[model samples]
Target chain A: MALLEVMNVGIAFGGLQAVSQLDIKLEKGHLYGLIGPNGAGKTTVFNLLTGVYRPTEGDIILDEKNITGKSPAKINQAGIARTFQNIRLFGEMSVLDNVKIGLHNQIKYSAFTGIFRLPGFKEKEQEMDYKALKLLKIFDLDTVAQSPASSLPYGKQRKLEIARALATNPKLLLLDEPAAGMNPSESEELMNTIKFVQKEFDVAILLIEHDMNFVMGICEHIYVLEYGRIIAQGNGESIRNNPRVIAAYLGGD
Target chain B: MNAIKNLKPSTCNNLINYGMVLVFYIVVQILVNAGVLNNSMQGMLVPICTYVVLAVSLNLTVGILGELSLGHAGFMSVGAFSGAIFWMISGSQMSPVVGFTLAIMIGGIFAGIFGALIGIPVLRLRGDYLAIVTLAFGEIIKNLLNAIYVGWDSNGFHFSMKDVSALGLDESGEVIVNGAIGITGMPKASTFTAGTILVIITLFVILNLITSRAGRAIMSIRDNRIAAEATGINITKYKLMAFIISASFAGMAGVLYALNFSTLAAKKFDYNTSILVLVFVVLGGIGNIRGSIIAATVLYVLPELLRELQDYRMLIYAVVLIAMMIFNQSPQVLAWRSNFVSKISRSGIAARFIKQKRQSEEV
Candidate 1:
């Protein structure tokens, strides 16, 4: 069974269809790439899978459980965690605290225990601190753990976002343009980190990237979208040779 | 001193806030014992403590939760009335300590209920829409309380919205609440010591909460609702939790405020009161608990302390307000303040003291 299965999912906004007839099957512990032109509904697909938007048609199943139309939090609980294209980090909080927020559901303590500083609260908090630091250490962000999320440089912020997502302990991790604003070297470094995360965390990764070299270098399989529809799906070499993929990017002659 | 300095940043921060309150309490006690405080000065103490608690709780909603609530006073009114009614009903039956504690709890619980009710509907609305709705809710509460009339006798409580005659209470029935007149002849149970203790308790709960799992969740929502939701944080749950906790504290403060005066009026908990608390939160620096305590105390005392200046007092107060705003909000001022604080902590008297202590420890 696939780790994530999107069975003919589609979402329409009134007269316009944002995403239509989208189908994806992600196997466990694999790195997949999603590429598309601007406004090809790549983020819309992410939103649908994460339950930020309920699909107008079709179902989404994660780990063999049908999770379509569930709330974002519930979808996350069902093991689908995603990073935003725009890097929606908790800016004012500490880098360590941001990861701890991801561990919110992982450890349980009531507001009552918190206010009174009960024994369980202290014990759970220490465990959370340890867990959060370990996750931060993975991204080499432990040194700046006390620094605010916004204060970190752009590349570090992206890494922090990924670390935060991984803290949720998901089966399928979605990355929306993980290398959007990075230089080549930075993107290369991010590519390595993403690969490490895939192997180390042992979670399937479905990433949307525009950098062809980065995608071709890391992804085992790639899907090309144009006009909210998958134009082609194949290995990197096959995708590169496909004339339709060329037409969508370089325009047809 | 070294031990305090070596503590975690959050723990050190908590100690500073708690210590500041304790020191202030002790100094005031000394002044009172020395007969340095006038009757008017003494009278202002409990109210100052009340406003401090109000400011801290409001900061939880406005600062930590990142929501502008214009109906904080509405919750306070609910608590004040509910707690006052409890005291009236249980009159002289319980000891003061137990009765007062129960009244505070009752006040907090009632206010918390109102907070949850308002939060469920209004929380769905954001920004100015939320503010406007909360403002309307505050006005509604005040108006509703104005029309309510309640009295009690051996047969139980009688209630009416019309005239007092419509209540149809027996001749022995005593009116606890008389429409716009509100609660009258209520015993004064609030003292400065009690007020200070309540302030300490408020700080403990709020500070502890900020470092807790739930507090992190609430703060994450405040920072980025989209990210928080993506991380599986139950948005509504954390939002309502912050709102209710804030309301409950405000309620307890309200009960303390009401019990200090024999005659308590619903109009006392008006929009102006809510705005007054908001001013303290804003001036204190949002999400800065220590700043809230100082701002609340200083701002509340400034006008009274300047009373001898006559007409110039208002002018001075306005200037002080502007000064505080700049001090709190201006980028240049903030940078300078941080620099100044770092300098003091690193190389000033605090540094020298730590150095001396370290040298002695080595010996």
Candidate 2:
């Protein structure tokens, strides 16, 4: 059975159908891409999948457990984590602290332990610090770990968001426009990093990216979306040649 | 060696603060007991302590945790009435220490339960709507308190305030509170020493909580709810935790206020008190614990300090608040202050000594 299955998911806002009868399935370690032009409902789909917006009608099954309309925190606790299209690091906090927050669910210390400084609390805190440092090192952000997240350059902020999501130890990861503001070289680097994350973390990835080169280079399978509908789903080369995909991107018959 | 050197300044500051608070309280209490200070001055101290505790604790919710709640006064009212009633019934039978302890605990518990109830409904509403709902809830509580009637024992359980006061003291010799007229005769259980101790304890707990992981979770929710949620932090649960804790502290402060004054008035825990506390939090650095405590003390004492101006006291306060808002909000004012300080230090010969010391330490 697939690790995640979305069946006939539909969501609407007022009269606008933001997403309509969308379906997706992913195996444990697949590198999948959801691509489309602006307002193609790619992010809307991400929002639906991550439980940020509940589908008006449909079922989202993860590991044989149905998780429809669960709170976003519940979805994350169930081992699905995501980054925003616009980097949403806790800007006032230090870079390492932002990543540390992602580890919140895993920590075993109670509020009582936290306030009174219990022995187990100290050990758990040390463990969290070590884990946060490890994740920071993976993103090559250890040097600026103590600096406030807002003070980081835009590229580094994006990297920090990814590192923070990874710190949650999610079984499935979703990246929304991960290369939204990157130059070619930076986009190239990010493409390799995404692939590396998929391989090293042994986690399935569902990403929405408009950067064609980055999407085309790293994605094993690509789904093209237009006007809240999936127009085509196939390997990258097939997507590149599809007439509908071409029409969607070029706006022609 | 490097870690110790780095930690030295903060550690020294902490020690100095503790010593100063201890010395100040000791001297103040001695002066008060010696009758050098008037009853009005003593009365002013109660409000100052209560406001300081309320402002500092409310900062946990508003400034650091970043949720706007105006129902804080409601929680304070709950605590005050509950604690005052407890003291009235059992205070004369028990030692002052035990009575004070019971009062604070009752106040905290009452406030905490009400806080959780109010938070469950309102915490789901974020930003402006949340503030409005909480403010409405506070008004509702005030109206509810005004309407509720607990019959007086005398004259076959009379409903009127006149009849309630006629019920006379319990065996404890304290007058039972008459509904909206408030707790008439509470024991003057809180001393300056007790208030000072409570302040110290509160500062310790708040400081420790804010610097801890749970505190950081609360702060992260304030900073970015979506990011915090994606990280598996239950935003509502943490926000409620902040709310309950903030309310509990405010409640404790209310109990302290009642005990200090030997009376409780419903009008005292009105909307204006909540706004006053908010001003204290804002005028001080919002998230800074020390700043809140300092702001509460300064603002509470400012009115009294200008009491010689009599009727103009309130006018002066309004002017000062407006001026402060204008100056604090302007970036140019901050820049000018920084520039002026820099210029002064640069012109002083002591600046060279300090710069040399800093360089030596860096090396």
Candidate 3:
């Protein structure tokens, strides 16, 4: 069975259909890309899948469990995690703590145990710390684990956010414009990291990116969206050369 | 088990705080027993402890949860009146021990229930709107108390809103509470020791919650609500949890206030009192439990100590507040505090506490 399936998803706000009849599917460990011009409703589809918005009509099934319209937190605990188009780390907290929060669903210590300084509180906390450190290490962020998240450089902030998302132990990961402001070299580095994460974590990826090179370089399958509809979708080579995709990006007078 | 062996700063921090409270309690009690403290100084002890509980709990709402609550005093009044009624009803047959203990329990529970009730609706609104709604609730509660009347005797229990005459109690009936006048001639059952114990419990609960997974979720919400929600943390549940816990502690403070004094009036807990508690949380450095405790105790005592300087008292108080604001927000001071904290965690009591715990586990 496929790991995730989105069937006939549709949504509208004030008579304007933001997305309609969107269908997608993913097998385990697959790398997929969603690309579009500005305001192409790519993010709207992501918001619907992550439960930030309820589809006006559709079903979102993960591992055969219909997860449409659930709370964002519930959708996350169901083994999907995402990074924002704009990085949203908890600025005042340490880098380690930002990652640790992603592992919130995995901790088991009760209020009683926490209050009484019971053995379980200690063990669970220490284990989480170790796990958080390991995640930081993967992104070369272990050295600055004690620094506040906002203190990190912009590129590092993006990497830290991705690391934090991975700490959620997701079966499916979503990246929203992961290479938004990076130069060519930095975008190249991010592409490598994306591929590494898909391979090492064995997690299916659905990333929204405007950067064609970044998306085409790493994605096995690509879906193109424009004006709340899927204009075209195919393997990277086919979507890149598709006339409709080119026309949407390079608009006519 | 291994987490305990690591002896995280929170565990050691609680221990250090407990010691401070315990030592302070003993020293003050000893001073009173030895007559080293004058009558006025003695009178201030219970209030100090009560305000400590109030400030620390308020910190949970204002500091940690990052929500403003202007009806904390309303919850306190709920606890104060309920607790006072219990103490009065049981005064005849029961010992003061049972009366006061039951009073605290009933008071805390009622305050907590009201906290949840009010929070469910009010929490839906954020920032200034919440503050306005809670402020309105506080005023409403104060006015409600002014209209309530309660009495009891062999005939039955009586309660009325309009007037005492409407209660229709016979000559044998005893009036426990009368409209506006409130409870008077109540037994002074709130002791310094009881207040001290309450403070300890408040610290334990607050400290424990802050270190636990639940606390992390709450703080995460405060730091970034949308991000926290995206991380799968239930925003409403944790926000309500913090609010209710904070309210109940304020309720416990109200119980202490009622028992420590001879008369109980809802008017004592109004907008001013709520603001006073907020100031304690703020001056102490929001979300810092130890800072809140010290700030509350010292700030409460300042007015009494300035009694001799009556004419210039308010002036000095203003000056002190301004100084505190500067000291609290100064960049140099904040940098110094963070450095001090890291040092303390590395080689201070935290290190020693961890070592001791490990040694005990091995033995």
Candidate 4:
């Protein structure tokens, strides 16, 4: 069984169907790419999966559990975590603190314990600091851990978001335009980070990217989306040769 | 031990806040002992403490929680009445320490309950809508308290809203709360020491919560609600928690303020009082805890000190408010201030002065 199975999921906003009949199966530890044109409902799909919007129809099962229509927080706790397309970071927080926020549910202490600064609270916080620092170190963000999230360069901010997402210990990770606004070199580095994250974290990765080179270079299987529907689904070789994929990107004559 | 070493910066910062409060307490003690403080100055101490507590607690909502609450005075009013009522009923029966402690706790708990009640619905609304609803809630609380009349008699506690006569109290009964007039003849158990102690406690709870997991969650929501939610944080739980904690502390401040006076009026905790606390928060630099403490103390005490200014006092206050606003917020001023601070630190002026003092002492 796949780690994630979006079985015929669809969402409509009144007169408009934002996304429809989206079926994708991602096995554990595999890297998948979701490629599409502008306004092709890529982010809307992510929002539906993360329960930002309850699907008007269909079930989203993660690790054999049906998690459709659950709140974003609950969906995350159910082992699916996602980064936003527009880099929605906790900008005012320190980079280290941002990742620690990701570890919020994994380690728990009561509010009373926190306010009182009990021994248990101290121990838990130390543990969290250790864990958060370890995660930051992986992305080479440990040096600037004390710096505010917004102060980091754009490329590093994107990396920090991914690191924050991975801190949730999810069974599946979704990256929405993770390479957006990055130069070619930064995109190349991001591709390596995504590949590393899949291998080390052992979570299935589903990412949406507009950069064809970045997508084809890293993704084992790719899904091409246009007009809120998948135009093609296959490995990079098959996806590149498919006439429909070419026409969607280059525009039909 | 190594983990502790790693925690030095934040721990040291917290220590500095506590130390500053302790130093202030000691200096004030010295001044009072030396007879340097006047009668009026001494009298202003407890009120200053009360405002300090109010400012800090309100910061937890307005600054850290990232919500504008115009009903903080409402919570304070609830606490004051509830605490005063408890004291009137049981204070004479117990030791002063025990009675005062219980009174404030009752006040805080009552206010916290009200916070939970108001926060549940009010928190669903964000930004300006939240502010307006909170303002309305504050007015509602004040008006409701004004109409309430409660007395204790052989028939136990009696409550009536129409008037005191409708309470049907026995001849032996004494009114604890009279409509409009509010609570009177209450014990003035609040002292400067108690007020300072409450300030310290407020600082402890708030500062500790800020660095904790719960604090992180609350701050994340403030920084970015969507990101926080995506990170598996229960937005409502943390938001409500911060709001209640803030309300509870505001209530405690009210209790402290009420006990210091012989008479307590619900009207005192009006919208203006809420705005005054907010002014402290804003001028202090929102989300800056130490700044709030300093701002509250200086701003609250400034008017008292300026009594001699007479006609010029109000004009002077407006100027000072603008000055503080620019000093705290203006981009050019902020850059200059940061540069000044960095230059001072890099020049090692304080460090050199400390070294010289140590050498002279050793000699």
Candidate 5:
């Protein structure tokens, strides 16, 4: 069975259909890519999958459980985490504290315990600190951990977003335009980091990237979307040669 | 082992903080009782203690947790009335210590329930709309209390404050709340020690809350709600928790205020008090507990100190606030001040003495 199955999902806002009749299945441990031209409903699919917007039709099943219409927090708690297309770090907070928020759901303490500094509260807090630090170290952010998140360079900020999402211990990770505004060298490095995360962390990844070369290099499978519909799906070579994908890219169909 | 080493300083800091609080409380008690301070000074000190608690606790909702709640006075009123009523019914029979404890707890409970009720619906709204709604709720509660009659007596229609001294006694004779005139002839219950101890406890709770994981979570939400939500932090749950906690603290402050005054006036907890508390949070650095305490004390005392200035008191206040705004807003001014301070410190004879001492010790 697929790890995440979307069977005929549809969503509409008012009179306009943002997404219509979309079906996609992601198997466990695979790096998948979703790519399309501008205004192709690529982000709408990500939103629908991550529970940012409830699909008007069809089912979203993770593993074997139907997870349609769940709140974003619940969906994230159920082991799915996603990054925004735009960088959305807690800009005012220290870099380490930014990742610490992802560890909140796993921390075991009530507000009373926190308020009073109950014995167990200290222990759990130390554990969360250690975990947040470990994640920061993995992303090479440990040196800048004390700096405010807004002070970080653009590339580091993007990496920090991924580290924060991973801190949630997600089963599936989604990257929305992870390489939207990176130099060619930075994009190359990010592609390797994405592969490394999938391999080392053993988490499934689904990325939406407008960078064709980056996506084609890292993704094991690719799905092409156009105007709220999937025009093609296959391995990298197959997708690269598909006539419909080529026509869609050439603005012919 | 590494974690243990890193954790040592924080633990030591916690112990030191508690010790300091105890020492401070003892010193304040001694000063108040030794005839070194007058009754008017004590009166001013009592509200400072309560407002310190109120301002720091309210920061949990307003500054750190990022919710705009203007209904803090509503919770204070609830606590004040509930505490007053509790004391009126049971105070004379019980020891003052027990009566005070029970009254404060009763007040906190009623205020907490009301806080949760108001938070549930209003927390759904964001920013200025939430502020306006809570402000309206506070006024509505105040007006409602003013309109209702609690009982009927020889003096005609009895309200909350009427006959307060006569209702608590047994079949012999007693009073609970005086009708409409407000609670009268009640024994003064708040002492310097009680107020100081409560303030210490409040400071302890607020300090711990800000440093803990949950405290950090609330702050993170305040800093960036979208990022916090994306990380699986429940925005609504944390916001409501802040509101309820802040309201409960405000309630506790109300109880202490009532005990200090030995009465409750419907007019005592108006919108002006709420604005005053908000000013305390802002003038103090937002999310800084120590700042809140200092700000509350200074702001509360400043008005009394400036009373001699009479008509110019408000003008002076406006000028000072405008000056603070200007000082805070101008980056160049801040930079110049810092540079000046650094240059003086580095060039002074004190710096040379310290440097020589360090060099001699190393030799």
Candidate 6:
């Protein structure tokens, strides 16, 4: 069974279909990519899958469980984590705290246990500290562990966003424009990080990127969207040769 | 070992904060013990501690939860009246200490329930909307309490609306809450020691909550609501947790306030009262718990210190507040603080203390 399946999911706003008939399926540990030009609703599709906007039409199944219309937090608890097109690190917090919060669902202790510093709370803290640092280490952010998140450079902030999401221990990870603001070399580094995350954490990955080379390079299968619809779906080799994909990208301009 | 090294910075900050609270509490106690603080000055103790609790709790909601709440006074009034009523009925039967303690607890629980009720819908409204809703709630509760009449007679407990005549009691009715008169004949069970203990408990619980998983979830919501949700934090759960917990502490403070006085008035908790607490939080440096304690104590004590200069006291307070706001936000002050901490840490005294602490704990 697929790890996640969005069957005919669609959302509309003021009579405009922002995302429609978005059928997506991800097997365990697979790397899938969603690419579309400006105004093609790639981020909207990510929002739909991650529960930012509930689809007006069909179902979202995670691990064969129907998760349609669940709250964003519930979707995350069901093993789907996502980053944003805009980096959303907890600005005033330490880098480590940014990731520990991502582990909110996993920590097993009550407010009473925390206030009293019960044995379970401390054990959970040590466990969470271990897990958070491990993810930070992978993203090369362990050096600035105590620094405020807002102090990080743009590339580091983007990487930290992904690291924080990884701390959530998701079965599937969604990256919305993770490579948006990076320089060529930075995007290259992000690609390596994405590949490392896919293999190291063994989580299926889905990313929305405008960078053609970056998406095509790392993605096993790519879906091209146009005007809230998936225009084509194939491996990079097939997509590069598809006429419809070319027409959508060009808009026949 | 590497993990321990990584943990050093945040742990040191906590140590400094804990040390500050202990030192402040002890210094005042010593001054009182030495008779350096006069009767009037000593009287400021309970109020100072009460305000400290109030400021810290409000900071949790306004700073940590990143929402403006103007109905804190409403929650406090709920706690104050509820706890006052409990003590008045029970104080005669039990030890004063037990009665007072129970009063605060019951008040906290009641306030927490109100917090949940108001927070469930109010917190869903972002920013200014939350503030306006809470403001309305504060006024509504105050008016409701003013119009409430609780009395007792040989027949049993009697409650009436608007006036005592509605109760149809004979001349034997013991009026507890009269219209606009509020609760009268409140026993002076709120003492300085009790206030101090509550302050410590408030700090311990609130500061610990900040470091816990739940606290981080609340702060994350404050920092980035969307990212907090994306990371699987149930925003509503954490928001209400912070709001209710904060309200409960404020309620405990209200119980202390009622105990410190002879009578209680619903009007004591009004728009101005909420604003005063908010000023303490802002002056204390929003999210800083230690800062709240210091700010509340210093600000509360300032007017007392200038009591001799009664005419000019208000002017001095206004000036000090303006100066504090400027100094608190100054880049130079922030830089100096970082510099001072780093210098002290490099001396290894902090590290040595940590080592000794670790050894003692292991033992």
The top-ranked prediction according to DockQ is 6
User: Residue B142 in model 4: shift from native, Å?
Assistant: 0.4
Question: lDDT tens digits, residues B121-151, model 1?
Answer: 9999888999999999999998898889999
Screening candidate 1 with a backbone cut-off below 3 angstroms (N, C-alpha, C), the clashing residue pairs are none
Error of 1 at B89 (Å): 1.9
Q: Tens digits of per-residue lDDT for model 2 on B171-201?
A: 4343355566766655578777677877787
Please list the C-alpha lDDT of all candidates, in the order they appear: 0.90, 0.81, 0.87, 0.90, 0.80, 0.88
Docking verdict class for candidate 4:
medium
lDDT of 6 by residue, B1-363 (tens): 365455655666777776876786789889988989889988888888889999999999999999998888888999998898888776536888888889999999999998998889888898998999999998998999889998877787788876987777767777878879998887688878888889888988898899888888889999999999999988888999999999999899999998899899899999888988888888888888877888888898998898899899999999999887765667798778778877887787886787777678669
lDDT tens string, model 5, B1-363?
Answer: 233233333444455556655676677678877988776776787788789888988888888887777877878888887787778767646998988988888888888888999889999898999999999988876766554434334444334433343333334443444444556666778876777777787777766776777777788788877677768888888887788878888888888888887567767788998888888887775665655776788778877878889999988887766665455435686578658865865797545655565557459
Q: Which ten residues in a row have the lowest lDDT in candidate 1 chain B?
A: B1-10
> What is the clash count for each candidate, in the order shown?
0, 0, 4, 0, 19, 0
Off by over 4 Å in 2: B1-39, B147-175, B309-363
Provide the lowest-lDDT 10-residue window in model 4 chain B.
Answer: B1-10
For model 6, the superposed segments whose C-alpha errors exceed 4 Å read B8-12, B153-156, B168-173, B348-351, B359-363
Candidate 2: interface RMSD equals: 2.7
DockQ, structure candidate 5: 0.63
DockQ-derived CAPRI band for the predicted complex in model 6: medium
Sort candidate 2 into its docking category. Answer: medium
Each model's TM-score, in the order given?
Answer: 0.96, 0.87, 0.93, 0.96, 0.88, 0.95
Model 4, range A1-253, lDDT digits (tens) per residue?
Answer: 9888998988889989888999989998999999988999899988988989999888999889999989999999999899988888999888989999999988899989998877798789878888988888888898888878999998899999999999999998999989989999889887887888789888998899888898999999999889899889999999999999889888986
* Model 3 misplaced stretches (Cα beyond 4 Å): A182-189, B1-7, B91-93, B170-172, B340-363
